[model samples]
Target: MWSLALLFGLVVCTLSVPTGRNSPAFAIEETAEWIRYEGYVAETHNVVTHDGYILEVHRIPYGRFQTASTAKRPVVFLMHGLMAASNCYILLGPQNSLAYNYADAGFDVWLGNARGNKLSRRHEELDPDNQKRDFFDFSFEEIGKYDVAQMIDYVLEYTGSEQLHYVGHSQGGTAFLVLASSLPEYNAKFASVNLLAGVGYQNYFPSLPLRTLARLTNTIYASAVALGLVEVAAPSFFRRGDDDSIINAVPEDEYLSELSTITELLRDGADDSDNSNMFGGAALKQIAHFGQNIRDKTFRRWDYGLLENRRVYGSVSPPVYDLSLITSNVTMHYTVSDVLLDERDVLAMVNDLPNARARKVAREDFSHLDFVAALDAKELLTDYIIESTVQIENLRSTGK
Candidate 1:
């Protein structure tokens, strides 16, 4: 009976549910509730970028266990991976969440939502619904140049700090590399950077499914655009499974039953309320850009085809991002089981960095999603993050 139910649920998710815009509007409210439930104070702030996109940044000023002496703590900025928002860090709930762990350790934790995600979908001059192309014309290049830069500046100015510790996962790490390579002036702004399951070079990908999908990305994106759908959404299994906001949007009993069925296959110890909300929305161009990286095996800017490349870049080929420009003290964390990023690719990325250290997860079976959703993630990764931050702080104080 259980096996039949699980199979049925998988079939339903695979066929019926569409990705992207299926989430509810109460994401912010649910986020607030999750933070407070875990004994942390949550503050939501809107950041307006120079390019006119409005982003939502969440802050945990202090934790319940914090003391008055730790009032003005060192700031730590945490950015999520592809198709994820600030919710990724808090989805595991307070006890196991990285954001809460940072706050408990006396660091002012700020979660950034990149442009076009659920939280940062508004623009100054263009409406997302009315001006689809203009509103969603960016890839990670723009994210690195505008969103990351503006968020770092806002956090620094708001905290009155000269430098803050940085932590990024996957595309978050990619954006940091892009920022350091393009805007080298920001190198001094980070005390230390910890990249988890990050991607730098795409010369090799381990997942057969991903590789196959990459090959078809251009075709799929073109078809979607022709069909009047410009926004791409990740599959539902890639996100949180227990978000109350999504639950509130559906019939409680039916939602719970479906949730149980879905989790049977993608079990990561998440509760029924923990529905996947990883994918908000991404531009068609952004999807194509990642596909290009996978196909070209080079971490370069978007290819505007040959004709447009000459006009925009003065060459037929897009210029490769110079990884050597990233001089910040950096540490990379990867697991052997991550299907998207192979060990060789990660080693290649680390080899290019001027100042870097590499750490592998102890668990041989620790997969990509495990970094955020595994039951033992706190012990396997979050503890290491806390310890590394302390070490970085010590090094800064001693001027090492």
Candidate 2:
């Protein structure tokens, strides 16, 4: 039995889902184009991590472009944010995205899926079907230290490069900070780090409705876990499918209806001619880190109950990491419109890094997902950043 206060709070969460009308209409043509663009021919190579977890590595051909070969182009390891997969860089609806852009620009691209995601769900001797084969014994801390460190080593070994560059979006960015703090030896292996819409300081942004819900829900989640309703923490989106929202303590059918309502909000008034879902379960989890980033201010980590619960919590998020000793050459990018992570909080993380700087995107109305989701990323964002990054790398190289 649920209390009225808890029920009402859940209602508030559903009602507040932002409508699609608020955003500029997504272009159907662009969506079609994105659907058609060629992704790198990826080869799967599995690596066993120090902790006995297995990670799936997708290696895109490095020599497809001449620029990468001629310049001895540096290898870049790409890590997706929370529940997302490596596919995110490929599906931005026709606008040339970073995944393609970096490959086109001659850098060897390797997109990493965090452990427990659909693609990276593997352990050495454990069967996923076994009841024991659920989302357990994992958190972002494991990702940052063991998963990332191993992937970094694998990329260097695969590319035969002594050093590599890194780019992490949202939680991906946070993971590297964790890596730096715990496995500082890996720092020497990376040349630079590009943090897109990162999270480290929670106090820097304005209070949003979702942030408030997170505070409430975090407590609810703690209680739910205690009561053995651990699945409530997983994000409801997985079950909702094309629906609007999830019903707390309700049947799947009713929850599906609410999910439909939320979907309407996400797809409001768009040319019904063009209804495209550019994100997947893995990708959504990747981005949810923006919220978790806020909830776990100052490096506290979260358990993975929210991600594992199939019925209740589709948004089972990983724990927050303590980043007190993250000392890396890091550059953070922020746009005025990124509602998920405000510029102030991103900058505060920049301030914390031993060697860090901040870059503000010229436009304001950008949301957090736009860093990778927007169709115009290559033209509007990454190219500029890459050009400047290369120049900066050059200057540092000469100085050294």
Which candidate number maximizes lDDT?
1
Give candidate 2 misplaced runs (Cα > 4 Å): 1-39, 63-72, 93-95, 132-134, 223-297, 302-324, 392-400
Off by more than 4 A, model 1: 1-29, 65-70, 233-278
lDDT of 1 by residue, 1-400 (tens): 1111211111111111112323342343366655666667888889999989999898888876543453578999998776567777876666777888888887899999889877888999989878877788888888888998999999999999999999888778888989999999999999989888877688876755556556665565555455455544433323343553223122322333344433444332223433434345556566567777877788999887798899999999999989888899888899988866778888887898899888899999997777776658899999988988988787877988
Q: What tens digits encode model 2's per-residue C-alpha lDDT throughout 1-400?
A: 3211122111111111123323333321232233233433446778788766688777664533232245556677888765355656654422355766666666677877666655666678755335221443445567887888889888898778878888898768778887887777777887888888765566644545555545454454445334433222223332333343434444422423333423443333122323333222232222233345455554544434554643344445543344546666788988877655667777767776788889887666765676776655666678876776577568766986
Worst 10 residues of 2 by lDDT: 8-17
lDDT of 1: 0.72
Best by TM-score: 1
TM-score of each: 0.82, 0.71
Which lDDT values do the candidates have, in the order given?
0.72, 0.56
